[model samples]
Structure formats: C-alpha cells, structure tokens
Target chain A: MALSADESSRLGELLTSRAEQVTQQWTEIIAGQLRGRLSQAELVRQVQELHRAMVDALGKGTVDLNGEEATELRAVLAEFSRGQARQGFSATETATGVFALKEALLAVLEVDQSIETLRDYVAFSTLIDQMGLFTFESFVRTRESLIADQAEQLLELSTPVVKLWEGVVAVPLVGTLDSARAQVVMERLLQTLVDTGSPYAIIDITGVPAVDTQVAQHILKTVVAARLMGADCIISGIRPQIAQTIVALGIEFGDIATKASLADALRHVLRLTGVETARRQPRREA
Target chain B: MERVPILKIGDILLVSIQVDMSDQTAVALQEDLAERIVETGCHGVIIDITALDIVDSFVGRMLSTIASISRVLDAETVVVGMRPAVAITLVELGLSLNGIRTALNVERGMELIAIERADEPYDERDDGPIPEPTASP
Candidate 1:
C-alpha cells in the first residue's frame, strides 16, 4: 500500500532520529549473512548510503518506490546488487542484505508498542520488501549480461584460423560443433582464405569428439563455402570411430579430401603444391 | 549504365568488375566480353570480382552465360577473387556457378588458364601404346 503523507513524515522522522543505530544494526545483520566475504567497513558504507537515500525519499513524502524522490534510492539499491553479483554472491544472499533492514527497523519499532507504531512498521516493511525485489531484479540482470559476454568471448576463443603453411591455413576445432560455432568457424576460415589468399585450408577436427550428421553437415557447408571462394578445404583428423560413424551414416564427403591427420593433410597439400620433401635415409656404409 | 572495362593481358582477357551489377550493365558486360574475346582471339578469360560486394542470381546467371559463350568461342573462363560473404550467400542460395572454373586470385587464375592451355596439345595426342598391325593373310 502507498504511504500516506502523515506516515511518510513519521517514518522519515523516525529514521532520521535513530539513523546511526539503524545503519549500524543493518550493516551488522548484512555482515553476519555475508560471513566476512565482504569487509566490515565496506558493508557499513553501503548500508549507510542506502539508509540515507531511503530517508531522503521519505522526507519528500514519496508514496511509491517509482516516485521521482525515490530515484536516488533506486540507484543506490541497483549499484549495491550489481556489486554483490560481481563479487560472486548468490541471489538469496544479495537480497538478504536488503531484507536485513527490515529486521533492523523491527528492532527499533519494538520499543514502541502503540497500535499506530505497529501500522507504520507494516507500511515500512512493505517498502523495504519492494526495495529487496528491485535489488533482486538488477542482480539477475547483471548476472545475465555477464553470462552473455562470457559466451561471446568463448565463441571467439574457440574458433581460431591459424596459418599452418605458406599457402595453407588450419582451423583446429577442439570442442563440440554446434550450429553457431560452426557458422563462426566457416566465416572466419573463409575470410582468412580471402585475406591471406591461401588456396588451401585444412579443417583439423581432431579436437571434435564426435561426428554426428549435423556436425558433418556444418563441416560440409564450410568446405563448400571455402570452395566457392576458390579455396580447397581438406577435412583432417578423422578418428577411427568417427570414420565408421560417417560411413554408417551414409554421409558422403564426395571429392573433398579427407586425411587421417593434420600431418598427412599438410603433406598432401605440399605435394599438390609441388614442394617435394626428401625423406631422410641412413647411410648403409660406415 | 557503367561499362565494365575488359583488359587484354597477353592471351587472357581480364575483367575486373568493380561496380554493382544491374541487369543492363551485366548484359553490356556479356556483350563486351564476347566481342573482346573474338577480336583478340584470347585463349583464356579471367573475371575478377574482388570489388563486387554482392552477386545475386542475375549476376550468377550472367557469369554462367559468359562462360558458356567463351567456351563456344574456344576460350576458357576462370572466375576469381569472390568475397567470402558472397560465396556463403551463393552457397546458401544453391548457386554453384556450374560449368565455370574458379581460382583463389588473379595470379592463380592465370596459372590455371596457362596449365589448361599447356595441357591441350598433350591431351590431343594419343599417349597410349599403339597396337601392332594385324598380319592377316
């Protein structure tokens, strides 16, 4: 329920009169919940900022948390929750930090047993509940964005087109080839082919654990895309089981070269490029 | 319509398409390339698309038609320098530019044409062992 003008002023006066005690109690409660994961001084500073913002909002007679007067309060709460999230705190623990204020307020309100004080406590408890929910939401948002950034970084880190030879590049795919990663691999490999003008590319799937039909299809599409750009793609690193699986699945690589290993693939490309590597032999005569 | 210039380098006609291809421009290119091939009697044609950012179906068909026309005129055509994005788009669209040879760049394209031309005389010769004349009485 929205706080009336009288209730707002009464709560503001109550908070201001016992500001030091309330903030101290609130900080202690949060510190106990965090179990020293956060330092005592930092916790006290955060609690003081939140306490001051709330009092300022109440002083302006703000009924709803969405009111213009509550802007500072919301900002303080959002920053606190975001900070907590980045520190690896759980959502419940972060929300508890805000909810601890209710306990601190109840301790102060328990001294006054009047029915009017009881009603004011309930209204103030609802406001604190709203603030806890706001903190929870921002915490989740911060966590979600953190996950998204990590996912992008992982995608970039996984697919690397490295030059293995003068006119040959290789993409050593080390993980599962999902559609998204496959698309990235295809684009990066093709772009590298154009940028480096490498006529040959070796897609070493040694790191690929399994070759399902879908994975094979992604690989085929990449090879075809590279071919269309006038570059030849050789699929290397075929595990024995993967070869069996490929044949059993009736997936035809059809004219696109497949090698047993990256070395074999490199040798094949070198031969095609007419770079003869003379094999070393031991002398028969001493 | 902007005319795509065709440069004749030795026995190969080089067409570097730098502008966006409209229908009229593509047709003009087809006509110009055909005339240039006959006038120079070039044995090879290299179409460089390094600057073309897009190659829709129309341009694709134009390439195929030009390839077919040059083949009829006893010349080989090699399409080179297609951008990766355009290649992906074409592959997605299922246009593989059939009957047209492709190379990585202009240098490779020239090498390809030279290789084919050099092999032509050998291909015409019968390298297999000759059969002994029958001694029928």
Candidate 2:
C-alpha cells in the first residue's frame, strides 16, 4: 500500500527529525539478534545508512518499493546481503536485520496517534518486508554462483593432462565420473592430444573409486574420441574388482588397450614407440 | 573445376586435400585417385587432411569409399592429420570412419603404410624372435 502525499510528507518529517531514535532502536534490536557476531560500530553504521535511505525515499514520496526512488536503498540492501552471506550469516539472521527496522519504526511512530502516521507506518513496514526478501534472494544467488565456480575449478584441477613422454600423455583421473566431468575429460584429452601431437595417451583410473557400466562407456567414448584424433588411448588401473565388474556387465572394450597399472601402460606405450628402456651399468668397482 | 591433386611418391600415392571440397569434388577425387592407383600400381595411399577443417558426412563417406576402393586394389589407405575439432564433430555426427587407419602426420602415415607392406606375405623367418641387444660383458 502506498502512503498518500500528505502522509508521506508527515512520515518523512518524523523519520528525519527522529533519525537518532530510530537508529538507536534499530541497532539495539539487530545487535541483540546478532549477539556481537558483528561489531557494534559496523552494525550501527549499516542501520544508520538504511534508516537515512528510507527517510530520503519517503521525503521524495516514493511509496513504491521497486520505484526509481528506491534504487539506492535496493543497492544498499543487496550489498548488505552479499556481505552477510560471505560472512557466514544464516539467511534468517541476515533477513532479521531488515525486519528489525519495522519494530524500530513502529516504536518511533507510536508516540503519536494520528491516522496519517498510522497509514504511513504500515506502508513502511510492507516496503521493508519486500526489501528484506530481496536481500535474502540475492544472498542465496551469490552463494550458489560462488559454489558453482569452485566446483568448476575443482573439476579442471582434478583432470590434469601431463606429458609422460615425447609422444605420450597421461590423464590421472581421481574421482567419480559424472556426465559433466566426463565431457570435460573428453574435451581436455582431445585438445591435449592435438597440442602435443602425441600418438599415445594413458588414462590412469587407478585413483578412480569405482567403475560401473556407465563409467566404462564414458571411458570407451573418451578412447574413441582420442582415437578419432589419431591418438590411441590405453586405459590403465583396471583393478581386479573393476575387471570383474566389466566382465559381469558384458562391457567389451574391444581393441582399446587396457593395463593393470600405469607403469605397465607406460612401458607398453614406450615399446610401441620403440624407445627401449635400458639400464646403465656401474663403473668397474668405482 | 577445383580438383584435389594426387602425387605419386615411389609406390605410394599422396593426396593432400587443401580445398573446401563439395560433394562433387570429393567424388571426383575418389575416382581420379582410384584411376591413378591402378595406373601407377601404388601399394600405399596417404590422404593428408590437415588443411580440411570440416569433414561433413559427405566427405567422410568419400574417405571410406576411397579406402575401400584402394583396399580392392591391393593398397592400404591411411588418413592422417585429422584436426581435433573435426574428429569430435565427426564422432558427434555418427561417423567413426571404421576400418580406416589414421596417423598423426603424413610421415607417420607413410611409416604405417611401410610397416603394413613390410609385414605382408607372412614370412615365417620374419616371425622369429628378435635377438636381445646386450652390452659387452
């Protein structure tokens, strides 16, 4: 509900004239809720800024919470919510900071019994409620994006392609192979294959926890993709249990090579490239 | 009027596809190469596609056909230097170029062809165990 022009002017005068009282009461309410989790000086400054913006909006006759006049107030609330979210404040706790203003304003407006003041007071309460919900929504959105960014970084970190030899590279996978991660693995492996022009790649899955049919299919798809780029893929680290699972599932890797360990796979690739690993002898009795 | 050139190197035929081939051009190349393979009696064919960016189903099918034709002529066909993007797109487009051998580059492709030719006729003496290399004791 919007406050009438006259009511808006009357409330605006009350808010600005009684600004100190409103800030005091609002700080007390929020400080009580936060219990010194945030410093008193910080809390007081935020309360004062919100109170001043609300008063300024009321004076400008901006009763609509989403109107152009409320832009500054919205931006302040968004920043506040984002900060609170990063500071480890719960959603309820962060939202209570806005809700507490309603109580503070009510206490200040109750000193008078005028009908116009009562109407403006209710409008103010509704505006604060909308603003509070907006802050909570912004907080949740920021946290979600932060988590998504970290998850992407983790995915990229876990799938590192190392050049094991002149014409060979290896991807040491160490986690669950979901469809998304599988796509990343496929893309990175293909790109690395082209960059290195390596004819051989070893996909070491020893660190991979387990492999079902779906995982086996992902591995096969990756191998086929690499082979399409002229690089043969050797899937190493086929544990006895994983081997049993593959056989039980009737999943055939066909011509794609499989190895029991990374070392054996490396040796196979080395032999394929015809680079024999010869050991040197010690000098005669030093 | 653009035609992919087929060069004869010893007993091997080298075809480097440099143009964006239309279906007609791809078919022409296939015909011309098959004729040249017979005329020259080449034992190996190397198709270098390093410059060809997009290998749609038409070009891909042409490659498979070329490989099949060369096989009938007692020659091995090796496709080499397929870009990563083209390979990925080909797979996504449901064309794996099955039965077609691929190599990293033309040199490797030639080596592959040489190996294939060297191993032909199945000599029993060639199958004997290789002697180990040992340093002087």
Candidate 3:
C-alpha cells in the first residue's frame, strides 16, 4: 500500500521528535541481543547511523526497497554486514541487530492511540525485515570469499621445489596427494628441472600419510613428465609400509629408481652427475 | 614449406624450434630429423623448444616418436628447454613423452650425451679406493 504524503510526513516528524528516545531504545535492544560481543562504542555508532538512515528513507516515502530512496539504507546495511563478519558475528546475530530496531520503534509508537500510527508501524517493520535479510546474505558472501583466499594460500605454501645439488632438484611431499595438489607438484618440479637444467629429480613422499592407487598414478605421471624433460626421477623416502602398499596395489614403478631416504637419492643423483666421493680411512680407537 | 633447420655440432644434432609448429611441420621435422641423424652419424640429438609457446598433443607425440626413432638409430635423444606452460599442458593432456630424455638447455643436453658416450663405470660409485702404497722405510 502506498503511504500518502500526509502519513509519511507525520511519521517523519514523529521519528525526528523522538529520535533520541528511539535511538536509545534501539541501542539497548541491540546491546542486549549482541551480549557484549562487540565494543559498546562501535555498536552505538552503527546503531545511530542505521536509525538516521531509516528515518530518512521513511521520509522519502519510497519504501519499495529497490527504489532509489533505499540506496543509502542498502549501503549502510552492506557496511554493517561486512563489519560484523570481520568481528566474527554470526549471520543470525547480525540480522538480529537490524530486527531489534523494530521493537524500539514499536515501543515509541505505543504512546499514540491512532490507526495511522499502527499502519506506519507495519510498513516500517517490513522495511527493516528486508534490510536484515540483505545484511545476512552479504555477511555470508564475505565469509565464503575469505575462506577461499586462505585455502589458495595454503596450497601455494604446501608445494615447494628446491634444488638439492648442481644437477638435482627435490620435492618433499607432505600431506595427502589430491589431484589438484598433484598438478601443482608436477608443474613446480618440471619448471625447476628446466630452470636449473637438472637431469635428476627426487620426489620424497615420506611426509605423506598414505599411498593409494590414485596417488601412485599421480607419482608415475610426474616421473614420466620429468623424464620427458630429460630428467630421470627417483622416488625417495619410501617407507617399508608404502613399498608394501605399492606391491599390494600392483602398481609397478618400472625402471624408475626408488630410494629409502633423501640421502640415498642424493647419492644416486651425485653418481649420475659424475660426482664420485672418496672415503677416508678409519681412525684407531683410543 | 619452411623447414626447421637442423644444425650438427660435432657428433650431436641440434634443432632449435623457433617457429610456431603446425601438424605438417611437426611431421616434416620428424622425417627430416631422422634423415639428418643418419646422414651425420650423430650420437646425440637435442631439440630445443624454448622458443615455441605451445606443444599440442600432435607435437608432443612427434617428440616421443623422434626419441624412439633416434634410439633405434643408436643416437641418444635429449629434448631440451621446454617452457613451463608447455610441460604443464602436456602433462595435463596425459602425454608424458616417455622414452625421451630431457635437458634444461643445449649445454646440458651435450653433457648428457657426453656422459652416455663416456661408457666409464657410469653406474658404479663404489670402487674400493686404490690401496695406498706402503710408506718407503
């Protein structure tokens, strides 16, 4: 129902005259609902700003929400939602802050015994409800994007390819070997191989918790890629358990070298690169 | 038809692919490389793909075929200087270029060929240190 200009002006005047009382009641309701989760100063400022925006929107008489009059209200709501997410407020709790304004306005309107006051009250309630839901949605979206960014950072940190020697590079695999991480592992290892002109690569999976058929296939595919790049790969840090798992799964590593430790892999690479170390004679015990 | 030039350095044949490769070009390269390997009696082949931006499956297969044919001719094949993107794309496309050797550059490729040709006790790192001669008294 369209609110007549007369009714809108009357409601606007009531909001202005009772601004202090309405804001006080609204602040109390929000503070009680939030229960000391947010700083009192911040809560008071946000509540006062929202109260003013709502009053202005009502005065404009364009409460269609999507109407231009609600633009300021939408901006305030979005900023409030983002702040709540940053402050660790749940969506429900944030929405409750907006909803509490309705209670405060109703209490202020209780003094007037007129049907027009009641009608104005209903229209304000609907507007606040829409604002509450919008805040909740914006809060959820902000939280989701934050989570995705952190996950990407963790993925990058997990995969690091380091050159171990003049002609050798090593990737010490940790955690589970999912396809996504496997692709990262392959890409970094191959790029390092090309960059350093290393003909030997060691993929150490000792930090990995378990090896299944899929993990084995990912490893084999990586080994094949290194070979194509002119580097022979050695699978290192293969614990006895992983060895048995490989056998049980019938996964053949073919001619690819397998070593029990990184040291052994390094020694093997050194030998391939023509680095022969001479041993010293043992000293007599004292 | 522009032919990707094959330059021979000593007993090694070097082919630097500086042009975007079409399927016909890759095929011609395979045939030309095989003929060059035979004519030069080269012991090693180094194909530098650092200049090529993309290596689709067709070119990837051609690389594998070149390695195999060179192997049959008794010449070790080393594909060198593959771009990072091409390597990732090739692996994603599920072609590992197995049966091929890779080097980071032409120099490393030459070193690999030298090592292969050296035929010294290459795999054995543990020959007991020669017994020190007894000190002259």
Candidate 4:
C-alpha cells in the first residue's frame, strides 16, 4: 500500500526511536551479563540469546507515531544513545566477548541509520564502526603483548626470523620447551621457511628440557607448513616425554621426518640425496 | 680484553661486551663472549659481532651454542651485528641460528632484556645466587 507523506515521515521517526532503544538495551544487557561473571561458554550463549530477544522485540515493521509522538521518539532515542555512550567497559576479545557486544550495539545502531536519510546513516554507522574498530585494535594489541611477554620469559631464545630457508635451515634447540616458547619456535620455524628460499629445515630439539603434545604439535605444524610451501622439513628433537604425549593426546605426526639429533638428521639428508658428508671418512680398505 | 661493569635491570642481568669479530680473532672472540656470560652471572647475554667482515660456521655455531647454554642458566641470549652479506651466507649455508635470540645491536637486546625483567614480583630481592646452567648430555 502506498503511504501518504505524513505516514512516511512518521515511519522514519518510529524506526529511529526503536533503533536507539535497542542500542541502549544492548549496552545494558552486556553490562548486566558481564557483572554476573559467567564462564566464557555461558557468557557467549547468553549474549547470543540476548541479541535474539532484542531483535524479536523490535519487530520488522514501522511503529506508527503521530507528529507529536515523532518529536518525543527522537528525544527518547537521543537520551538512549547518550546513556549507551556514557557507559561501557573495555571489551575483551579473548572469547570474542567484545566482538559480541560490538555486534549487538551495531545491530541496533543500524536501525536508527536505516530510518534516517541514506547518506546521513552511512556516515553515522561508519563513524561508530571506526571508533569500535579502534577499540578492538587496541584490545588485540594488548593481547599480543601479554603473549609475547610470556614468550620472552620461557623460550630464552631469540629473533623474529626474516624468512624461512627454502633448501635446509638447521635450528638446534636446547632447554625446556614450554608452551609459550614452543609457539615462538613453531612460528619462527614456519615463517623462516615461508620467507627464505630453502626447501628443507631441521628443527633439532635435542636440547629441549621437556615437551608434551602441545610442543610436539608445534613441531608437527612447522613440518606441515613447510610441505605446504613445497619444502621437506625435518624435526630432530624427540624427547621421551614428547613421544609419550603424542600417544597420550593421540596426536599423529606421521608425516614429519623425525630424527634423533641434528647431526643425525643432516647425515640422513646426505644419505638420501647421495651426497657424502664432509666429515664422513672414505670406506677403510681391508 | 675490554671489560664493562654488569648492570642489573630489574631481574635481568645485562653486561655490555666488546668483541672484535675480525677474521683472525672471531674464534677467540666467541670464546671471550661465552666466558663473560659464564663469569658475569647475567641472565641475558648480548655479544657484539659488529666488528667483523666475514663470519664462518665456527663463529656461527659458537653464537648458537652460547644462546643455548644461557637458556640453561635461565638467561635469554641475543647475537647481533653481522654484515648483511654474512647474514645471507649464514642463511644459505643452512646454519640457522634458529631458536636462538638475535638483536640488531646491544641496545635493542638490553631493551628486550628490560622487558623480560619487568615482570618479576616487585619488591622481591633480585639478590639471589646466580643460576647455574644445566648440564647437557
């Protein structure tokens, strides 16, 4: 049905007010739920449900408002926005927690924009998103710093590799392989492969103080990522506990070439390629 | 041999090292670095390899080994200053100083060390005995 000019104006105002109400509700819901201090799984589920309920309450169509009601609706929406903007703690991205709140806020904020002129709404939404994105960027940066802090403490190793060698790059690792350092080791190994021209890299963990499935998996991925890049990767550090963890975690690393030591792996590489090691003596004459 | 007093920055130990990495002296230089780290009770060791033109496997292995041993002593290690070409050569030879720490110079290494030490329990005395490097098989 074609609407009269008065009705169209009324519809836009109604939509605008509804959007603002929904956004305010989103902030409230997030704060209330967070205050509950629920477990991560519970928190995510609650947020999802809350989002659904708000969407349902707003309904799909126009909420008719008289010209006078239109003015009141606009004021109510402004009030709600101020309320929303006034409060909101730092968003956590670990469980997509902050993302969830942002998502809910945007959904309602979009409603207001939709009711307004197209160009105005676009600018508004973009500005809001930029602010939200900046917040999110800082949150991710903080998370990365926390992780790197742990890495420095545990790995006692160094460098962000410029690139991975394409042929063979040997990494001889010693000491205990904690999860944080293990991840750094894994990333460096893989990144070095991706960055360099080398095809085969050896990660000799003969000096690793200990290991578990997590560390083993880190080793496993370096090899896998290497193969994905068309390189043969070798892992040379297999402590007894690491082997047992693979069994315990049921982690399978059958594809990676495992050797007992770096020198041993280098020898095997020479053997397979029909190249004699410089250190190997010629066959002794009887 | 030039000696610089060791500076304690929080829980980390930083000792500035001056090793001339000339082709003739690189081996002795490596030993000197390894010894200073062992002697100074530092938790993070930075070896300045900025003085050399060419770096061969022996020096590379020494750097890599120094990093490994420091970890045993609960210290992080970094090797800095090889000519760009030498860095490329080390990569080409597959003598990856992998799983070992690296820095552009002594200053950056110390900055990293400072970051490492800042996390210790505040107010706790850092005056404990030097941590002994673990025995290798």
Q: Candidates' TM-scores?
A: 0.91, 0.87, 0.84, 0.29
- lDDT (10s digit) by residue, model 1, range A35-94: 668888888888888888989989888888888889989999999999999999999999
Instruction: Check candidate 2 and list the clashing pairs.
Output: none
User: Candidate 4 chain A, which ten residues in sequence have the lowest lDDT sum?
Assistant: A57-66
Error of 4 at B52 (Å): 39
* TM-score quality measure for candidate 3: 0.84
- Span of ten consecutive residues with least summed lDDT in model 1 chain A: A28-37
* Per-residue lDDT of model 3, residues A187-271, tens digit only: 8898888777777899999999999999998998888777666678999999999999999999999999999999999998898
Instruction: For candidate 1, give the docking quality class from DockQ.
Output: medium
lDDT of 2 by residue, A163-279 (tens): 999989999999999888988888888888877778899999998888998898888888887777678999999899988988999999999999999999999999988998888
Indicate whether candidate 1 or candidate 2 has the larger DockQ.
Answer: 1
Off by over 4 Å in 1: A279-286, B22-24, B122-137
Please name the candidate that would achieve the greatest TM-score relative to the true structure. 1
Score residue A96 of candidate 3 by CA lDDT: 89
lDDT, model 3 = 0.84
Error of 4 at A226 (Å): 1.5
The alpha-carbon deviation from the true structure for residue B103 of candidate 3, after best TM-score superposition, in angstroms, is 2.0
> For this target, which candidate reaches the highest lDDT against the unseen true structure?
1
Superposition error at A140 for model 2 (Å):
2.5
What is candidate 2's CAPRI-style docking category based on DockQ? medium
Chain A TM-score of each candidate structure, as shown = 0.95, 0.89, 0.87, 0.38
In the predicted model 3, the residue pairs found to clash are: A229-B102, A230-B101, A230-B102
Task: Report the error of model 1 at residue A256, Å.
Answer: 0.6
